[model samples]
Each structure stands twice: as structure tokens, then as C-alpha cells.
Target: MQPSGTPSRRVSAFDIALALGGLLFIFLSAQNAGPAIAALRADGVQGTFTAQRLDCVEHPGHEQCSWVGDFRSDDAAVVREGIGFYGSERSTFTPGATSPAFDTGRLGHVYGPGGSNEWVIIAALLLVGLALTLRPLLRLRRPPRTPAPPPVPEHLP
Candidate 1:
């Protein structure tokens, strides 16, 4: 018979390792989720800016006013004008004409960082963590699975 008051070594090293792994999964899931959300948010913001905003620029002595989305700013004057009004602008002017290198209107409304892909990855990781954490706990509480008792050995006559 076992002595009284001695602690039973019930938990195995494997179980503890699994718990640690599960925690790692939880941490990783959160980490991955963050960047994904940021990307999607950025995309959303860019989309909104693209759809809902406009820029305008005025050049000195220019015959016609060049507006945002106009041909593009090739000359320093047009570049300055764009910066004056829009706060910042990127332009690419080739021999023929100038054009915005980037669309600020589209850049302002991004909403997600990583989007659905990150969401799925994080969710799966979280689920894995939950499963890992629960499985051992459940097994620990469960009664020992044993075969039905065999008939008692025949007693001495």
C-alpha cells in the first residue's frame, strides 16, 4: 500500500509540453492577426480614398488649371502646386505628359492590414490552442479507463 500524504505524480512531462505548445499557438495567433488586420485596414482606407477623394492644383501663368487626376504634373510648378494643395503629391512626368505616381485619394481609406488570410490563420491557431489546452484537462478529470474486473482468483480451499 502507498504511504499516506505522498503526492501522486499524475502529470507527465508530455502533458506539460503540450500545454506550453498550446500557449505558444495562442501567442502566435495573436501576433499574426495583428499584421493581417493592419493590412486589410490599409486596403480599406485606400479604397475609400480612391473612391471618395480628389486633389486639385493651380500653376502660376498656366493657361488652364490642372486638377487632381489631371494629365499629371511634369513641371516643378505643377509639382509645387500639388504639394501646396494636397499636402503631398507624387508625380511622374514623361516626355509627353505628367501623371500622379500615386493616388492619395486611394491611400487614405485603408481599413485592414492582412485581411481574410490573417483572420483565418489566427483563428485556426487559436482553435488549436484551445484544443490542446482542453484535451489534457479533460483526460485528467476522466476516470481511469480499465477493463472490467476479472473473476477473483480461486481462493485456497
Candidate 2:
């Protein structure tokens, strides 16, 4: 509270730290966006065909969904069990049965925080962090909107 009866405002250290953390993702995503996109578009053949929908058994702390099938291509040979992560929506494979390959080529796999979608998610986080950070700063700068005191009427003689 101020002497003028209005509340004072300041951006807290905790808020600043959180904002910085969130904003960092944006920069990080930008750094990875180019490479992730390129790898996804590169000459990769569908690694799995005649695929089967593999869901992790009802277990906590597991992703629980992916495709498992054999890898077949001119560059590769011999049927091998392959599993894909976080690609359920793109998969056409059904549980316990084989299906045509949904992917045209093998995926260019990256270690972590890779793929175009992850970039989008990071960007969203950055924007949210920016908003969270900026809101308090803006409030501090804005003048308090307290109403003016009413004028007193003069007494009649």
C-alpha cells in the first residue's frame, strides 16, 4: 500500500525467473526448427509396413501407443521389428494386424526435442511465458485507476 492509499506493484523475482525459463524455449525451438524440418523431409522411406498398433499395457508413466512392424526397403533388408514413438495419429496400422505403410520413407530421427510439432509446442510455451512475464510489468507501469473523491456540498445559511 502506498501513502496515497493505492497499492504498489512490482514484478517479483520468481515471476522473472519463470518468464525467462519459458521464454528460453522459444529460442531453443527456433534453433532446432530448421534442422527438424529438414530431417523430416529428407529422403527417408517408411520403416514400417504391415504394421501392428502396439499400445503399452495399462501402465502409468508410459507413452502407451506406437506402431510395431517389420522394416523393408531397398536400402535395408530382412524383416525387423521397428517401433515408432508419438506417431499414433499418423499411423494407419490397427491392433493385432498388418497394414500398408503410412510413411513413404524412413524417418530422420533426432535425439530429443526434435520434430516440427515439438517446435510448435515450444513456441507456444514461449508465447505463454512472455504473456505471464509481461502482464505484471505492464500493470506496474499503468497508473492506478482509483475513482476521485466526491465534492462536498456547501451548507445554506
RMSD (Å) of each candidate, 1 decimal: 15.3, 6.9
lDDT of 1: 0.45
Tens-digit per-residue lDDT, 115-152, candidate 1: 33446767889999978877678767876555466888
Model 1 Cα shift for residue 17 (angstroms): 0.7
**Candidate 2: worst-modelled 10 consecutive residues by lDDT:** 105-114
Give lDDT tens digits, candidate 2, residues 31-115.
6555445444532343334455565555777445555555544356534456453344334356655433323222422111122
What TM-score against the true fold does each predicted structure earn? Answer: 0.44, 0.46
For model 1, how many clashes? 31
Cand. 1 TM to true fold = 0.44
Q: What is the C-alpha lDDT of each candidate?
A: 0.45, 0.53
